[model samples]
Target: MSGAGSVGNDVDIDIGALFASLRRNWRFILVGALALAALVLLFCLLSTPEYRAETRVLIETRESIFTRPNGETAADRPVLDQEGVKSQVEVLTSADLLKKVGAKLDLAATDEFGKPSLLSRGLIALGLKRDPSQIAGDENMLREMREHLQVYNVPDSRVIVVQFSSEDPALAAKASNAIADEYITLQRAAKLQSNDDATDWLEPEIADLSKRVKESEAKVANYRASSDLLVGQNDSTLATQQLSEISSELSRVRANRAASEAKAASIRRALETGAPLDTLPDVVSSGLMQRLRERQIQLNTDIADLSTSLLDGHPRIKALRSQLADLNQQVRGEGRKILKSFENEASVARLRETELTRELNGMKAQAARAGGKAVELRALEREAAAQRELLQTYLTRYREAASRTDHNYLPVDARVFSRADTPAEPYFPKTLPIVGATFVAGLLLLSIFVLLRELFSGRAMRPIDGVAQAPANEIQMPAADETAQPVPGRAIAEERAAAGTEYPARPPASAETIQQIYDSYTTIGDDVPENPHSVHAIASRLIETGISRGLVVSPEGDDGSAASVHLARELADRKLRSILIDMTGTGAISRTMLDGKTVAGITDLLASEKQFTDVIHSDHYSDAHVMPLGLADPERAMRAIDRLPIIFDALEAAYDFVIVECGPSNAESVKRLTSATTQIILSVVDPDDNAVALSALDLDENGFEDVIILTGAESSTPTPPSGDENPNPRPAL
Candidate 1:
């Protein structure tokens, strides 16, 4: 059995076992450590010693210190320094370079790493070392030579390291230095070959490109001279700009000429219709018309004066009227002169517009010829531009290539900055470090083995230690002031009895004292939890993990029912369909606390008197429900639910949470419920007596998985049920 001993709501860890595990297995640990040390020492002693020698090569990215460094980038430094260094390292360890070194040193003729001891040969034959090539010659030795050489770059630096190892110290140093020297020579040879190749290919290509560039430029000049398409400041020809200006001016002149003609025509219409000549602005503003209008006004005044003072047949009055008529004729004559002037001006504007239109048409023809020539000139110019760019590129590359050839530039990226010295001691077979590491490894393994063994050991396999054990002197009896209330299902049995139906004759259950339980509800202003937060936390975990249903139990079974009811109520507050089921076979406490009677419960449902629908009752708080244990013949009811898995499954499926207040100290009920559930909470009468309480639980015998403790809050205590009377029962309806 796996026991989780809890304090409050947290399970206590047995830290003592971790320390005890090491104590009990100290001898085994000592023996293992000693054995590992011995093996390391033996291996170190037998291992062959070899000397290592290294040489450092400075990888010059742009220029060497001997040559004054400049801000200008090297002509050949296209790649980054890191990449260049990596390439040099690969070149130094290349197979071709190793083959040259092997031939020069006559490595195949010499006897080094050629014959191995039986143990080494066995390890090699087992393919620990790669199988050597079958071909027997300098090629095979060249491959072996590569294995002895190591090349790498120093961190954050352009310097490369060339290392070699051998039984002979002098040979190791000599080989390392020789490889570095050979790499430099190879770099020089490669650069010289590249410069030679570039010069040979580019010499003829550049000559041809230069000739083509001259030809393209000549053609561009000749085409420009032939085509009269002169380039303006904005790439447009002057003719194009001139033509656009003329076209806009001609449009404006034509518009002015049309307006003048229209005005003159309007004046002519007025003269023909004998409309008032004063209506025309030309006529009204004329000096002659204004003078005539003044004279007419004077004549009319004279004629009126003469008529008021003399007889109607006066010759002087008639003469003055004749003078007024003559003045009016003069005003009409002036109006005619102004109209004639407007007609002549309009006729001149029409002739000027005709001349401009003729000139504009000719200019358009000239622009059309120039435009065609410009298209051909542009195509020729594009080809010339392309040729010029290519020629410039060729000249630059050719000059650079030629300069390198003349200077005999050594294009090596790295030069040897330091040479390797013969090593005094072997770099391998570190005895002390090997021994220490092996000992530590053995100790680690031994600790794990001992701990696992102790974990499954009989003494550590104790049942849960959180069982609530009341003090020996003070038994957890029911509350003194409260006795049992009416049994909920007692009335259902009575109704059956009155109706002449056969009934279970068992004594009615004593109802429970329930104020303490009801007060546990936080809604009523009392929180009866040692840690309300922890209760909610645990409830959330249970709900999250799909436990949903479990029994709350105690060793003495005194306050377990009260605790169970409180937990169910808290779960209901979280909006879960949490309900309490008094599987105590006595709904006495339930009826008293709920202040309600069970109409028909599990017994009636099982007996076919009522269905499950008729038995479920809503509690006072939220939507939480309660299902009481109704009265039935004890023997038949127990037998009917002997396979209680079905009944518990149905109840769990029906509610989000089904809290079983299993009658106290019932291990069988706990086992049955836990098997069908994922969580089990154990309530305690006295939290201080944890160890004694845990021992009383006998969890190993019960076989429960998880058990949480609801402790230190004895404020909500349960009372004993005193009544044997049957409570009221309603019909199935």
Candidate 2:
């Protein structure tokens, strides 16, 4: 039982099953394994032995002469990562490398890997030999080398191993050593070839570079010579300096001219306003002019005094005014002379400023032309600079490459760390492994084959699926013993009565066993009917037989109500409308329904007081509609049940199935519904329930198309009453 439940656990493995299978079919495994091992031994003995030779190679990570710390080479070499190491490994096993080894050894001409077998040798002696060269040539030799060659990295080391196999031990060693030596020699040769190639290419490139350098430099010189910029080695031209010097001088000259012009204008303003000649600094600074101002003041004082003492034209006043006039005239003449000199200086300054302006403009024009020429000069210089830099770079590279070609000291990154030796023993024809593997594989296959054969033969017993076969007497048929099902279309009536098709006469199982059976029953019953034919098997039988009405009848037990509910639910789950008519007036469905309460039901329809839709209530257990005997008087419903013919006819026409829950009290209605229905499932509480068994047989005799018994448990076979006494065997309900 534990083993049976483990199948549902899904995580547990059944080791007991494996051991049991092995124990049962030990002979098959032994015989099959022995036979296979003998065959493997025979093959090993006949096959030719192969010797393997190995060579070890170490990849050097030493610093290069030119690339070592602070050496001339600019860019640092990239370090090999895991992928890079793998790439190097690929190079060792490449087809081209194998092809090179094959060509050097001339294995194609020798038919190295195509040695004639015994049969072929005999055929060849009889002048039936094929062309050896045509049979095995360059392509075959290359392929053989590729297939036989194996290169792999030594774990946790910077070394790789190359292995090869051959019939001849010495040949194997020779081939492996040759491959290693060729790989190293190939690397050195490749580098030397690259150096020589670089030298050849660089010679022409350097010449072109040198020519470009000279041409660019010459352009700079020519541009300098053609233009008048006269640019110096200091990056400044003479015209620029001259422009600077002239601009300074012009500024000084203009300042001087402006000073002279300002003085002249001030003197002219003094003369126009007729201001005191002493107002002029030059006039005031004159010794005679200062004396004349004093004399003029003295004369004006006298004139004022005389005019106060005498008449308007007094001699004294006239004399004093004349003196003042003379002094004023001298001062004016001094001021005029000073102003004239200033005018001449201003005129000279104006002429000099004009000359400087013309000279400055000429210098600016020349400087503008120099600026344009300077741009060309700078361009030429840049070209020269770039050419020189490129030439220097190529020269440096070419010199290094030339030195390498001259001194042929090319070192390979990898070398032979260890040379392969000739193998004394054959590496192949491993007799023990071959035989052991054959035996194990053969045993496994034979075990599976035997188990499958026994299973299909209906003899294999697995704890997971229960005892494969029950005894023929315990079950009803030999075939039914293999699977818990009746033989197709051949159910034994006795088995049907004991299992389900017929009602039980007695309780054969204990309470727990009956509960287990009910649990399994309800388990399958819960599935919504995605497959209608399976869930509605009973209803389907009736429909196939062109009948739509069915009855679940129990005369001795009350289990008919439950059976009827199950049948109607099954039919409803299949998307078929089913009405379970409880004509027994038990209200059993009402009591069992989660929220159900009985009310006046089917009797109302018979009395014409209610329609079928109004009185019908749906059952919580299933989608099936229930027409319970309602709150109406029980006597009325019992009497109105005589109208069941019309009611049953209407239900049959309206629904896919109508399951009538019948009791002994409603036996007449049962008979009428049964006659209308093509199917009748006789349900009993226990297999030993005597009354329903007798009623089931009577119903069958009375022409019910199907009288299926649903027994509650297994029971003993009971004797029926003798012949004519039981001719009409409808037990009193």
Candidate 3:
């Protein structure tokens, strides 16, 4: 018979027992592993060997500099990206290309691709699989080829790998290489067909473009002629050129008229003022005026000489004077003639300017009319130029297409770089790995089965020491004492059950475990207070130092617990929110503060029997809150006692001071509740007691340098007021 032991409803598993079980069954495990390895090896030896062969093809633009289009360079060759390479991989395995390869290799004549297997035929007959025979002959061959053929692009490269598997090594290599060769052939065939189509399409397009070119040019010529938009110098219209020339001539003629008029006016001024004719530039430039002036000078010289030598009325002197007078008259007459000639020149210049201005105006009007017509002419020219450009482009393309068609020089975008070679070894049924993996797997599986059998038979289980065994379905509540409180959820369930409503039961908590944990804490039974004045001092220190949380160690049991209550009440009196947690085994703090009311507390929370809200109760006689010792198994609650610091943290956040009264504890016993910020207080009726000194020394050794020894009155209740008329006497403090 098998027997199992459980502690708190958990089965205890023994590692030593499991190892012993494996030791006793080693022969069986070894035999099973060897049998599995032998079977795998035999299967490997009997399986048909499949030879795999591979061929590699590089996909890229194959055009050389000389064979490329007119304007294309070597750098302009299209390189395939990964997607393009993958597209070429699909092309390599295309149905049409594979069919060609299959026919070329005569794969349909071989047993591999010739007929369906007997099993496959049977399955097809039963409608369990599709029938290959129902497909066409070419499709059947293609389908068979697809199963054996593998095409994929190499990672991050334009190289595609084509592989084929067959029983015959030579056939594998032949089929792989044949597929690559046929793929290239198909690429070239496609290019050739495309070129032929382009040639056929371009013939009509070129002819139409040629006709358009001729018609557009004729329209340009006709428009130019009809609009009379004849181009002259610098490609400008004839009317514009004539207008420019006439305007220049008019400006020159007007300038000449102004110059002549100024000159004629100056000569007339000289004549009327009787100024010297030689001083006038126009008069001095005249030949007749200059001669007359010369003659007058000569005659004046002769008269002066004759008057000095002969009488005033001598014949020689008389002749000289008469000639001088005649010369003077001739000078005056010559000046008038020169002035009149200048006037006539001015009139001629004015007449020429008027004629030229009239011609310029006529030319401008003709040019303006031609400008409007020239806009239409320019539109025709642009259309003709565009058509001519399009025609030239078509002619170039048609010539290139025709040349290619005649030469049959279409090049494929890909080429076979490495031909497939026959594999020397079979590609599948690796003997060593198969046998080794089977052996390891079988050994592991058999070992697990043995362990499970041992565990299920209860031979691998042992009783866990110091763990209380209890029934899973039964819940044992802590025995009722002066401060033992009922679980909140259980109390609610009891009430609801009494009212004819059922509530779901909570999980069971072991009561024996909780009581053992509580009873295990050592307590001092002396309850007499030693120093009453020290309680006020401790409270004042706690308030002044702003201590939010502390661990209270009581060496004198209820007396020390009563001091903690007094300290909490004193802090409350000082307007600080204070809460006291009773962690003593005797429940002294809860008994004094709770006023005989039963409420769930920290132990219930730790045991998962009640929530925090259901565990905290208010003090009856003071403003402080109190947490009682709960009715949960202390052993199970101690399992979760590590959560005490978290509870202190939550109380510290809500209250100004959180004080936990530990009845009798050393440093190690309360280590979880202590931190750097937590103050340690030793509460004793006698400050000099051996136990009190030992507790303080223990806390000091555990890194708590500040231990406050508080001694106060034994009675937790405060004194009543003296006045009978006072309506509200002070409550317990």
Give per-model TM-scores.
0.46, 0.44, 0.51
The TM-score leader among the candidates is 3
Please give the range of 10 consecutive residues that has the lowest summed lDDT in model 3: 521-530
Tens digits of per-residue lDDT for model 2, 200-266:
9999999999999998998888888888657654668988888888889878877877777787677
Which residue pairs clash within candidate 3?
513-635, 514-633, 514-634, 514-635
| lDDT, model 2, position 430 | 93
Q: Please give the TM-score that candidate 3 achieves against the real structure.
A: 0.51
Which runs in model 3 stand beyond 4 Å of their true positions?
Answer: 1-31, 74-80, 117-137, 244-361, 440-733
- Which of candidates 1 and 3 reaches a greater lDDT? 3
Report how far off residue 377 is in candidate 3 (Å).
Answer: 1.8
Candidate 1 lDDT at 134 equals: 51
Residue-pair clashes per candidate: 8, 13, 4
Deviation of model 2 at 732, angstroms: 44
lDDT values, one for every candidate: 0.70, 0.70, 0.80
TM-score, cand. 2: 0.44
lDDT of 1 by residue, 54-89 (tens): 999987654554442234445645544788778888
